[model samples]
Structure formats: structure tokens, C-alpha cells
Target: MARQLDLVDFIVGLPMPVAASPQANPLDLLPRRPKAWERMVAHVPAEDVRISISTTWTRVVVEQLREDGCGDQLRANGSIVSHDVPPGLIWPEPCRLILMTATSAARIHKRWCLEEAPGTGLTNTFRFARQQHADRAAVSQQLRLLGEGQS
Candidate 1:
């Protein structure tokens, strides 16, 4: 004689659902915007760096560097400075300003990581670095041409 099936037995007898297939196109998986508090950084040769905080729509300066509980802190004068840039905020001079999320200073504890842009954002570390390098090279070339003309 067949035995009555218990709840656990019935559940165990059910077929498992098939896992969804991965997307065929990579672009379809891209995020709409960067996650909040994503870290971004830029290394500039200038004595002071200007940052435009998108959230507050204000500009701040990083005149010096400090090590603190928040890892590497950029300071203006004596106070620690931090900036926040929301998604879709087009910095007037994106080439000159380095934008980051506020928590970039408070949370992430790596000095090198603090100097990198968020993996996904309006601008990324690789692109920003390349642009800065290109800009410097262009200026150098222009200067050389002017010197040659004068000679």
C-alpha cells in the first residue's frame, strides 16, 4: 500500500525553478547612476585643488593632506574637507575639478583607493587620468612650439 505524503515530503518532491539566463548585452547591465557615497579622487600638480560638491553646489579647496580616523583626508587650511557630487551633475570645468561622494572621506580607509574614481560614475579614474595626462602633454607641446618660434 502507498503511504500518505507529509508536507516536507511533498515540498521535497517539487521541481526547482530554473535560474534566469544572464543578459546577452553588457550595456543592458550598466547602472543608471553611481551608488551614493562612492569614492573618487584626482591627483593634481597644483598647490591647491578645487572641488565642486554637486549636492551643496559649492566649491572647496584641498590645500594639504592629513591622515586621520577617516583614512586620508584632504584639508583646506586646518579643517578637513570633503565634497559630494550627485549623478548627472555636470561640473562646469570637469577637467579641473575632482568630484567625490562625502562618505569617501569618512568610510573607505585606504589611501590609494581614496585616490581613485568610483568604478561606475559620470567620470572614472582611468578616463580622468588619461585626460589629465593628455592635457599636460598638449600644453607642453604648445610651449615647445612657442619657444622654437621665438628662437
Candidate 2:
């Protein structure tokens, strides 16, 4: 006859590793911030434009111009400004705005296209739509270009 094991018996038979000290706080599991992030935060203004680049991609963030409804005016003028930003990317130093050329915008669009997965149809479509908005911003003289060092 075969030997059948109960729940407690099976659990007892399983190998267990030695236990370490428990964490005092859950936040202790979070990774430490990089030195670059500290430097950038110290130098950059909250209201300025910032571009963060990584090994695989780049991200642009434009802070909302709250004083005198300037952000609203910019939006009314068809500017491409976004206040919503995802965390994790470290922003560079604050920069002055420079007019973005259509050529440059096109290059940016091409880069996004290359980076996006071709298999993700819906995601690709959404990204393409965003690229079109950027292209429109370039045409409307509302797109701003960041220098290489700023990124």
C-alpha cells in the first residue's frame, strides 16, 4: 500500500531555509535614489521643462504654468504641454524653451516608432496618435526643443 501524507506532514517534509530578521518598515524594501537624481533636483526648478533619457528611451515633462493662467493660454494657443508625469525618471536641469523644428519632431516620431513593439497593435496606435499631436505642435510653433546636455 502507498503511504498517503496529510497537509501538516507534507509541509513538515518540505525543506525550509533559515529565517532572517523581519523588516521594521515596509518602505525599507524600496531602492535607494541615485546620486544623479539628487543633483538634478537641487539644480532644476519645478516649473521648467525637463527631459529624461535612458538607455532605451527618452521622456519630456513640462510643468504647468499656474501663474496668471499662462498654462491655460498656452493650451489655448495649441501648445503640447502635459502635467501628468510618471515616476522613476530623473529629470535634468531646468531649461529655456527653444522652438522645435518639424524635422526634429519627425525624427522624434521615427525614434518612437522604432522603439514601439510592432506586435502591440492598440499600443502602437495610441503612440502614433501621440506622435501626431507632437507633429501638430511642431507645425503650430508650440513645440519646444531641449538641448542634448539638458537631456
Largest TM-score belongs to which candidate? 1
Task: Report residue 59 deviation for candidate 1 (angstroms).
Answer: 10
* Per-model lDDT: 0.32, 0.30
lDDT tens digits by residue: candidate 1, 82-133: 4454433442223333333333321211111122334323332211222221
lDDT of 2 by residue, 8-117 (tens): 99999999998965523311211223344333333323223222222222223221222222221122233444343233222222232212223343354443321222
Candidate 1, residue 35: Cα displacement in angstroms equals: 26
lDDT of 1 at 28: 21
Model 1: per-residue Cα lDDT at residue 52: 22
TM-score on alpha carbons, each prediction: 0.20, 0.17
RMSD of each: 17.1, 16.3
> What TM-score number comes out for model 2?
0.17
